[model samples]
Structure formats: C-alpha cells, structure tokens
Target chain A: MQIFHRSTNTISRATIFGAVFVVAALFWVAATVQRSPYVTYAGVARPQPAPFSHQHHVAGLGIDCRYCHTSVETSSFAGIPPTKTCMNCHSQIWTNAAMLEPVRESYRSGKSLVWNRVNDLPDFVYFNHSIHINKGVGCNTCHGPVDRMPLMYNYASLQMEWCLDCHRAPEKYLRPREQVFNMRYQEPSSSQPVLVDGQPYTDQLSLGMDLVKKYKLRTATDIMSCSTCHR
Target chain B: MRNCRKISLLGALMLLLAGCRQDMHDQPRFKPLAESDFYADLRSARTPVEGTVARGQLHEDTYFYTGKIGNNPGDFMPFPVTEEVLARGRERFDIFCAPCHSRLGDGNGFVPSRGFPRKPPSYHSERLRKAPLGYFFDVISNGFGIMPDYASQIPARDRWCIIAYVRALQLSQNATMADVPSGEKVPSELPRFEEPGSGATLPVVEPKSANSAPEEPK
Candidate 1:
C-alpha cells in the first residue's frame, strides 16, 4: 500500500509537469500564427503584370501627370488610367509590344489592372492631392523625380515628420510654375536672366508664402493646426 | 492552492468588469446643436436671403450671347488683355485647357486623341466665333454643357487669362494683318488649327434671319 501511494504521487507530479509543457507549447504556436499580415516572405517579390515607365511618359514624352493619373489634382487616390485610355494609342501604336500585354489583356477581360501600390501610407492617415497642389506644392515636392522614374518608387519616407516639416514651413519649397516637375528644385541661375517671350520676368508671386501671408499665420504653432493635415 | 485562488479571483474580476455596462449610448438626451451664433444663423437662414453688398473687385458690365455670327450691341467689348496677363493665361491654358480644347481651340485635342467620346467645342465654329468674350469667360468660369466647372481649378484672374488666350486663339486663326498691332513683331507663321485626320469635317452652320434684327443693348 505504501509503494502504491508513492507511485500514485509520482504519476500525479509527472502529469502536472507534462500538462504545463503542453500548454506553453500551444501558447507559443498561437502567438506565432497570430502575427499580423499573413503574407509569406517571398510574396514581397511578386511581379507587376506590366512594366510602366513614368520617366518615358512624363519627362520624355512631356505627358502631364494629370493625363494618366486623372484624380491626383482632385481626390485622395491619384486614379490609375483605364484600359481604354491605354487602348486608344496602343491599339494603333504598339500592338506587338510585350510590355503593353497586360493593358491589352485588361481591355479584353473587362477587368481593371491590379497595379500594385508602391507608396502606401498607414490606413489612418488621410492625404489629399488637390489641396497640396493648389497651395503650390510641386509634384516633385512629395512624389520626388516622378518624371525621371522608370518604375515609380516612394521617394519620401512619407512619415508624419516628413509631412509635418513641409506643413510647418512651406516657403522654402515654393518655385516657379515652370519648375513644377524639375526635381532638383534649382532656382534660375544668376548668370542667365530668366526671360519669357523676350521680356525679363521675375517670379514675384511666391504662392506658399502668399498664402501664409494672406492667412496671417502668427506663429509656427498656428500653422501646424491639426485641421491643416488631419482633415 | 494560493495560485488557484489567485487565478479564480482574476477571472472573477475580469468577468465582473466586463458585465458592468453603462446605459450611456441608449439614454435619451437633449442638447444644443451648435456652439456658435454663426452656426445658428447658418442653420436658421432662409433661402433668397438678401444679397450681400458687393465687396472687393467690381465686375465690368458685359453680356454673353451664343448663336449667329455678327457684331450686335455691346459686341466686341474692349478688355485690357495685357501681355503679362496673356502670357499667364497661356501657361494656365496650356496646362489645363490644351488637353481637351487643343492648343488652337479646335475640338480635336489630346482627349480625343486618347479616345474620349465627347469632343470639346471648336473656337472656329460660328456659334463660338459670334459668342461674346464674356461667354467664353463664363464657360471657363462656370463650364458649358458636359464641361466641368474650371473655377475651382482656375482662379478669377486665371479665368480672365484663359479668356484672353481663347481670344488670341480665335484671332490667330481668323485675324488678318489689320488685327495685328502696328510696329509689333509678329510670328511669321501664325498658329492655325490642323484638321484632324480621323475627325469628320463638320459643316459650318448658317446664321438665322432673326439674328439680322436691330441689335439691342442689355
């Protein structure tokens, strides 16, 4: 009876230890499985259906950003051009080109080309292009050298600080309308006087500064109001 | 034993906290809708409110007419289209208007080139040719049929600028040496509308007999 009692006690202790180990293992597996996005490491390397060159269209061809991305100047999403827009020229122009295959495929399929977004912000942040563009923020100011980019990538970190810095002081970034797409943001060289139609023209209207002056923003604190960006 | 007791107490406390719900959301409530007098005025305001006194810039007296081609009362109103203003207008027009309206004001623009179903109005059309400068201004300011209001995209000065540019476009296509400023350097090759290869030739419409009546000043 003494031996049986000792055996029972040993069995109970072993069972408790085993149960604890099982629970710990289960907890660890659940934690690992619950890690936010379900995407695998290799999914980051997924290929785009077609290769589109912003540089070729913008800088080389002189097509305005508004031409393709119609909604940039008006809405939240700088909307992608529809397949019909592509087919307009492509039907007669480049019927045989492989790069434009997806465009043709979309035209035939009657489905949108799921172009992957490169410059994605966090879900909470709301950004509008019209307000910024209207306030004299150049395309290059935020989008970087979009005119020169072959496959556009996010140029700015797009972090809150990156945005807040410009909102805090927009004067430094202001340039002539001609220099909207000029990525270097170089001012007119001193040696060469800027002439428009054989007449000397100095840019008197600093749009950003004009706005700041018009609003009479008393302090840096005043300019950085939550509504300026958050809204 | 102590650990078991602690676990039970923790679970019970969590359950008690979760069970304790407030009726804040479902409760009947009444409060003032606005915090300011301005807001109250906005909410309580009636339509056809008395027109506010005009402030800042005063608009020049002008009338806009569509249809028929001929000078009438207040026809060809004089507007000071300075070179600086024209240049600014040209830049804005090139950026905004040139795509759909075309650089020469012909309906055959880049939008049509990209297969947009609706083509813009041609400045060459007699209806537009006879239209007052203010008509074009109004069109750019408030938009015509099927056209979106460009007022938001363009400022008041810029709208005036576009009007000047449109006049320039019309003048370039239709003007003779008499229209050119004397002693002023003119481009040897005046800009002209190129007939689009794919575009069907639209027949010019004749003016109605009613338009021949004596002009009345508005």
Candidate 2:
C-alpha cells in the first residue's frame, strides 16, 4: 500500500520540500537567463546569404556606413544596398570566388539575397533610423562597434527598458555631428573641454546639454511617452 | 495515490503555462504588395486615385523637379550654389556617388575596382567637364546606361548640390597656378617625407617567401 516502507533513515519531508523548491528556483533562473538579450541576441551572429565582413569593409577599407545602408539619413529604414552595389566591387575584385557565388546569382537572377535580420525589434515598435541619425545619436551608441564586427549581430537589448534608458536621457549618448559615424569616437574626459565653434564647453555632459538645446530635442517626458514609439 | 496526483497536477500546470504565449507577432495585416481580393485591381496597395496629389508633394517648379527646360536639359542650377550647398553636395556625393564615381571623381571607386561591369566616366574627362549642370541632374534623375536613377534616394536640392560639387571637383583637378587665390600660396610640390621628429621607426618586416635570405635589421 505504501510506495516504500518509511524508515528512520528515509529522507525527511522538510528536505524533500527544500530540494523541490531549489530545483524549481534553479529552473526559473536558467529560463530567465536564457531569455535575457545578452544571452539570446547580443554577440549571436545570424547567418547571411553572403558572409559580409563589416570589419573588412568598414574598418579595413574605410567605407562609410551610408555607402551600404544608403537611406540611413533619409528614410525610416536604413536601406540595404542592392545587388548592383555589391557588383560595383565584387564583379572585379574576387570575380571567381566560391564565397561570392550567392551574390553573383542574386545579381544575375535579379532576386535579392535574404539577409537575416540581426537587430530585430518586435513588429509593434516604430523605430526611425533617420530621426535618430540626424538628431546626433551616433551609430555606435546602439550598434556597439559595428566597424569591428566580422559578422553583424544584435548589439543592444532592444528591450523597452533599454530604449527608455536612452530616450529618458539622450544627452549621455549624443556625439558631435561629424563623429556620429566615427566608430572609434571616444567620449571626452570630464576635465577636457570640447570646443564647439571656438567656444570651449567643459566635459561631455555640458556639450551634450548644449547640443540638445541647439538641436531642439524634446525633453525626456515627451520622448518617453507611449505614443512616441508605439504608434 | 497522493504522489501520483501531485506529479500529474504539476505537469498539467507546466503545460498550461507553455500554452499562454501572447501572439503579437501573428497579427492580421496586409503585407507589402500582397494580393487582396477586397480591391478590384487584386492588389493590397491601392494606386493613387487618378490625379490625386498628396499634401506637400505639389511639385510646382518644373525645372527643379525635371532638370529640363522644355525638351533640353537646363544649363543652370535651380538655386544659387553656396558654400553650404557645396558642403551638402559633397556629403551626399560621398555617400551615394563616391561608391562608383569615387571621392576624387576619378571613376576608380572601391566598387568598380573590385569587379563592377563598367567603371563610370571620370568627371575630369573633357566631355563630362563640358557637360551642363542640368545634364548631370538629368542623368541622376533618369539613370544613364546601367546606373539606376537616384531621384527617389536624392531630393532635387541635393541633386543640384551634387552637380555643384562635381563642378568644383572638375575645377580642382584642372586648376592652373593662376586659379589659386592671391593671398594663398600653392605648395610647389606635395610634401612626401614624414617629419624628422616623428620618432616612429618603420618595423622591419621579413619577406614572405620561404627561400629568401633574412637581411640584417637597419
């Protein structure tokens, strides 16, 4: 009738309960950690039709971001370069390489190579590349050293909280207009004054604040509002 | 019996939790260019009603939009070229045109050098140097040969700026010593040598050939 004869040496009820609780807690922790963007998205390079190396193109050759993502400043989407853009170089440089067969096929067939999206946001979020780019948010701030990426991956969490963190205080992330595309641009030390139009502004905070005012940026409250992104 | 019931209940709870995903990604929507039976044209996207123009899209200036005066390409820019305009043009050209035409307008851009079918004609060429401002604009608006039209990517004003910058580049490459301003001095030769006080020495690199004899370090 009994599953096992209860003996004095058998495991205690308290110990069994404690063991179950620990197992459940550990399982929950493991699940939560796996779902975190750091584990799930960041540093995980999605496979692409072409093994394009941003490191070789952007860092090695000093090709500009706008050269490939042609509509970064003009459109909501940072447009992917067409096959012709690839042929503009590949048709000559590595003409017979096996690696570029897909690129050549895409060009010949007039079908776009489906590049896997690395930095995918949920369909609901209305992110605008032009507004962020033109407003002085550096590409590095969100993309996290794309020039050095051999294969591109999602760099930021793209979570609501992560977005609100920047939306709430954009000044910290702001860079000079020219340095927006400079992947290696460093934030000036607090003691070092950044000279803008011959006037020295001490530190990045003051410079960012001055830029915010100059650029006529909306305050955190307005930017962080639900409709600002959700719509 | 109690243990069996408990295990079953826990498994059922887990299964229930697994089924509770909010499917926001599966929302009903018409995809771009997706066929729709609701429309008579069998298209999800409806064509603009006859001659209906969207607000702020009324292109009143024909010359600005078309880059032509009647049938001929206009000889002049729609707006006066300024320092700001040229700067804007340079930025846009470097982004859009420089990939093929090159930063120097030499037709030896990274793209063409790699393996493109045809290299674009250099702006410094005599034919292009003599090309009217509108001719460049027309080429940009209506693509010439394999070059795609950039009308959608570049605005009319930016196109004009690109033309101005191209002209500036043409002038720069073809300039004589007299073209230099009175106060500014043109260097007789390009400064080739590095400064003596640079302090950095070039690292002695070995030849990659396995059979080559190693040389003593300088």
Best lDDT among the predictions, by candidate number: 2
Interface RMSD, in order shown: 18.1, 15.9
Worst 10 residues of 2 chain A by lDDT: A190-199
Residue A152, candidate 1: C-alpha displacement in angstroms? 0.9
Name the best candidate (by DockQ). Answer: 2
lDDT of 2 by residue, A1-231 (tens): 877667733667777878999999999998787568655587888899989998778766657787677778877888777777787567567889999999999899866567777776666778899898878898989999887799998888777878998899989888667657767666766443344544555578877888898788999899999999999
Deviation (Å) of A181 in candidate 2? 2.2
The parts of candidate 2 lying over 4 Å away from their true place are: A1-39, A88-95, A190-195, A200-202, B1-22, B30-62, B115-119, B143-149, B176-182, B185-218
Q: What local lDDT does model 1 show for residue B193?
A: 22
DockQ of each: 0.03, 0.13
DockQ of 2: 0.13
Alpha carbon lDDT of residue B68, candidate 1?
14
Extract clashing residue pairs from model 2: A88-B111, A89-B111, A89-B115, A91-B115, A92-B114, A92-B115, A93-B114, A93-B115
Off by over 4 Å in 1: A1-47, A176-185, A192-211, A214-219, B1-167, B188-218
Number of the predicted model whose TM-score against the real structure is largest: 2
Tell me how candidate 1 scores on lDDT.
0.58
